[model samples]
Target: MERELKLTVATERWNSAEEWKELKGYAKTFMLLMLLSMTFVILIGIGSYMRHEISAKQTTYGLATVDIKQSALQGMLAEELPYYASNQKLDTFSLSSLGLWLLEKVTNVSLLDPASLVASEMLYSSVEEQSTLIHGGEGSDPAIAPQDDKNMSLAPIDDEYLDELLAEVGNDNSSEPDEVPVAPEQEEEPAQPQGVESAAKPVAFIYHTHNRESWNSETSNDDAQSTKNNITLVGQRLAEELEKHGLGAMVSDTDYPTAVPDYEWEYSYKYSRKTVKEAIASNDELQYVFDLHRDSQARKYTTAEINGESYAQVYFIIGQRNPNWKENEAFALKIHEKLEEQYPGLSRGIWGKNANSGNAEYNQTLSSQSVLIEVGGIDNTLEESYRTAKALADVIAQIHQSEG
Candidate 1:
């Protein structure tokens, strides 16, 4: 198709300069309002962030209380879920952390990482599973389930004995002078402090699931703890002494605080299991693994007078929850025999506990050399505990040397 046309025309008569000027002024005012709003929003964000940081200053149990939550161990490989780690800390100045923190403040719910949430659900689920096994499983005895809530008693509650201990150790501090019980040795000068050449291959690994378990010597408060001076330091001392004696050793002072129930201790072993596995995985030479703990008994039951020196009594507790408990029992028996030979009466007989009474297997099914060693009690002094550690180190050194 084809067409052609041409025309000339002037501007419209409705265009007024005064109207244009008014519209331009309105645009500027609008821009100013927008700028003020932005500034107010920024100030609010900063204030919220500052408030959050101030409130979250206090320390937390494993994995901070980020409302969103999820929180391991084993021998048949390992459990499906990992133990809840309470050591996670939030970055104070991180933008993402700030925004999330604000969200948590605004909303009642928490926001946790996917993995952590999953792990937490799994851990609680496993607890329920263990409870079921202890209760209604085939071959489960009614005697084991006498108390409904006793399914996972962290510490043994022997009513009669515990009452006796409580009565003896009242809340107040002892009035008697705190003295260091000395060793007036009547035997060969406590086997000349033995030393071993430094080796790259680590032979032993020591850790405390409940590192806050303090003693009277360290904190002047038996049960109360100043994390600085607790059984954790004892474990480090043991590691240092062992390393000197040629048993190249490592010690972990990871504190697994009670993030759940106020006094529950069952989660401790699972926490230590993760630490031990990581340690052993990195160093294939780690053979001897110990989950050191302080007993909760009275002073008389925990202190041992041997060779004129005070040594905290050591007890071997084996868990029956795992299928490979026989291996753990065998090692405990061997140690018990050796201890008898070296320091008779110093070793308490092997105590077998299950989930029904105490933490079962205690991560023992992970390896043959795994053992839970309770050194001393809440009333025992740190000095006595250290002495026991030395004696135990000597026994382990002897065993390691024999193998070498």
Candidate 2:
């Protein structure tokens, strides 16, 4: 019986070992399948992510290219488009065609108005008349005497009075007789009217601060030098124009002994004030003073072509910081009106009445006729600015002659 029990135990052990091996094989297959499934999902996710990234990059590039193209188109429109259109005596082929083209091209830019541009040009043509009416009544000087039409009369002198005068002249001539004394022919010299001297007030004085040390503070040394050269050339031109109109003008540099800031905003008021005070101390028959400066606007120079020559745009800046602001503004308005009359669109406009913010005095307190004129930006060449100055001087000369 013991032998039989041992055989049964051995058979049971062999069956148990076979069942364990089968379970191990099934577990291994399940794990292998799970690993393969996970690998497939990871590969799909990576592919989807790469595709999405590439699409996003392409969209950004496309938008950037569109922006660049639009910018180029706008630049071409501003710079090149206007030259192709005719300005004088606009017709269907010129005005209408150009207007339609511009309208179509700029339709997407809703801010621009075609009518406004045309209106501005028309209004600019009538600036002189508008300015005169705006300032006061009548277009001529009011100080002259009125014509006397109703006081015309004719009176005859007495013949007896003339004979008596002749008899007295004969007696006087006889009384002056000596031993063969011959009377010299008495010639009456013409009498000149009072207050009719040849000397007249100057039109304007060109003033500037040549601060070499502080030139590079905001603009470069080259810019400052260009400004100086332009001013000098303009001064010469102005002098010539004044001479042509029989007016005496002197262009002198304003020397400030103390070192100060180059920029108008950074300049010390006390220093400027002191310098101006000293300059006026030696004021030898100076009538008008012009402080010349350059504007800070764009990186590229701004230039205008007038009468086949290029010129820079000028801005008339009046300072309300002085006690004589009203008088200064009046003087500036006179010049402004005259400029618009002679040359259209030469002046930018009159600015600086509101002194509450960012108002620099610019030494206008020295005289009622003082004004600060900004010629052009740093990008403008010296020749362009000089041309503008010459044009300004001509306007001033015309005004001065009219005043005289």
- Number of the predicted model whose TM-score against the real structure is largest: 1
Best by lDDT: 1
For residues 1-404, what per-residue lDDT tens digits would candidate 1 score against the true structure? 12222221112223456678889999999999999999999988986665554333211111223453221012111222223222333222334654665554443224664432343233123322222111121112222221211223335533343334234333423232111122345132322111121355777878777678776556665254656787887787787778768778777776667432454454455556556656655555668878888776667666667789988877777766554556677777777777778886677656655544545556665567788888877777878888888888888888878778
Off by over 4 Å in 2: 1-203, 210-233, 254-265, 268-275, 299-302, 353-356
TM-score of each candidate? 0.50, 0.43
List model 2 lDDT by residue over 3-54, tens digit each: 9999999889999999899999998999999999999999779756654543
Name the 10 consecutive residues with the lowest summed lDDT in model 1: 69-78
Clashing pairs in 2: none
lDDT of 2 at 208: 54
